[model samples]
Target: MQALYDVPAPAKLNLFLHVIGKRPDGYHLLESIFALIDWADTLHFERRGDGLLQRHDSEGANLPPDDLCLRAARALQQASGCGFGADIHIDKRLPAGAGMGGGSSDAASTLLALNRLWGLDWSLQKLKELGLSLGADVPFFLGGTHAFVEGIGEILHPVTLPEQRFAVVKPAASIATKEIFSSSLLAMSKSVAIVAGFPAHNSSENKTVDVTRYLDGFGKNDLQKAAEAASDDVVQALELLETKFGNSRMTGSGSAVFARVVQENGKSDPAMATMLQEAIPAGWQGRICRSLEHHPLKGWARD
Candidate 1:
């Protein structure tokens, strides 16, 4: 294929996050359940025979000098010694610094697309190893399923979650991941055996486990406190969602918060979704998103 159009890079919600410990390299080891959501950014790729990578923002938004997409392309090119290159265009739907894994997802999709576009035929494991060099969350997007993530987000255990909906809101302001991690408010959470009960390791076993009760009460985003300390927008977003939905928590690092949209008799309530969307402030962004079973680009690369 000479070009791949309208590839999706979906955002994720950390159903719950806990900082378990710190690595010698200053990276925080974390445990979280990352759920792919329908909210996403769209990307397009066109092949280049001259082996020169380029990126374009479809919305004409300013992007970083060396964005993750370009980095991923370059990495793949170098690793495979492929003479082909790509011109990547991003739709820029997801917000930056919202802890939604937008950049990571974009990078992962670039890897998947270029792998096929350039005819490299690299295995999924090889792509994942390269993806980890770009960011911890990149591998999860490449994994293509809702997962129980650990070890700074590289280790993944795919799980099956019941279909659910969420009301997600992002404030006008953004919080730096560094700022949240550096805050004095950040603390290591006590280790728990949440993974022991999971059937993710065995494909033959039934993977559909109900963890709604755990999400509702047992787990919490450990980064929320630190993020709130760094940005008041985080606090406001949480309060706004909590007041509307009765329970809310900050996802990932912060500036975005979400609450589970309670289903009534196995169906989502449209009125609740409309009310939540209307309640968001003018400068902020909010969406009622349904969880995704797998990434749209799941089988792009060989397993």
Candidate 2:
């Protein structure tokens, strides 16, 4: 009631992303599984009864005037008409613009944490609705576990996933998400709305049935080509990962690439985590992450 501590907004890896089609409104139709990762951003919240929302980095300095965390707080305050406010302090771990959904996750975590701290007690449905307004990826974070995301990420189907380990790397270069969405490759690849894999049942509602089989399907990130073209750092990182891990792919619309750390027995290789951190380029960031079965803040709202 007074403060919330150690609340986490975990990063996500889009196990695979496909730009299957585009909508009439220009939003691309998408299919991907967003798996929560152990890498996370942590936040602490304390009550500020004067109804003024402020966000600070953990070092006690205010964050940028328009950081998503602050925006989320303002949005939630407006949505709930709550007469209370909070002082938000974030311990940011996820890198910006790495396609790891850091900003969106922070916004979603703000919605979830404040829903309780403010006692608005909004249902997950309400929280997700607010989340969608903040960013497309926010709903997937609110979905509580690994999810089959569709309809530009607003639609989510929670799915079970086998425990897995990933070695994720963020290149020294930055690739804007807007550029990836508008890249020439996507323009050439866009087509009439057809879900080639299962066209007949690809409608959003129908696709929610089950994703177990699709998870095992040979999936690839649609935006990787564009990412590689946009940054030499991305290309170098991907090449290194592929050489070391035998396979690698970009996550989301990325400058970040990831590969499963697999052993000869097909289980995840534990030693690779530390080795990767040392092997990655001098300025590049790398970490080994385990996929989460559920969001750390899963119980914050009703299912």
Best by lDDT: 1
Per-model TM values vs. the true structure: 0.92, 0.89
- Clashes (N, CA, C under 3 Å) per candidate: 0, 0
Off by over 4 Å in 1: 194-196, 199-213, 264-273
For model 2, residues 1-303, the per-residue Cα lDDT tens digits are: 645655899999988887878889988888777889999989888877899887778663335778888889999999789988888889988887789999999898888888888888799988888888888998888878787777788877666777777889998888888899899876333321344433232445524334455554357888988888889898888898888878898988888889876665544445666678778878888988888878999988985
**lDDT, candidate 2, residue 172?**
83
Q: Report the Cα lDDT for candidate 2.
A: 0.80
lDDT of 1: 0.85
Quantify all predictions' global Cα lDDT against the true fold. Answer: 0.85, 0.80
lDDT of 1 by residue, 1-303 (tens): 656656899999999898988989999988788999999989989998899998888755567979998999999999999998888888988988888999999999999998989988999999999999999999999989988777788878777777888999999989888988888888677654434565432133424445555665568988889888778888888999888778898889978899888865554556766777688778888888999989999998888
Q: After superposition, how far is residue 183 of candidate 2 from its true place, in Å?
A: 1.1
TM-score between model 1 and native: 0.92
Total clashes for model 2: 0
Question: In angstroms, how far off is 274's CA in candidate 2?
Answer: 2.5
Name the Cα RMSD for model 2: 3.1
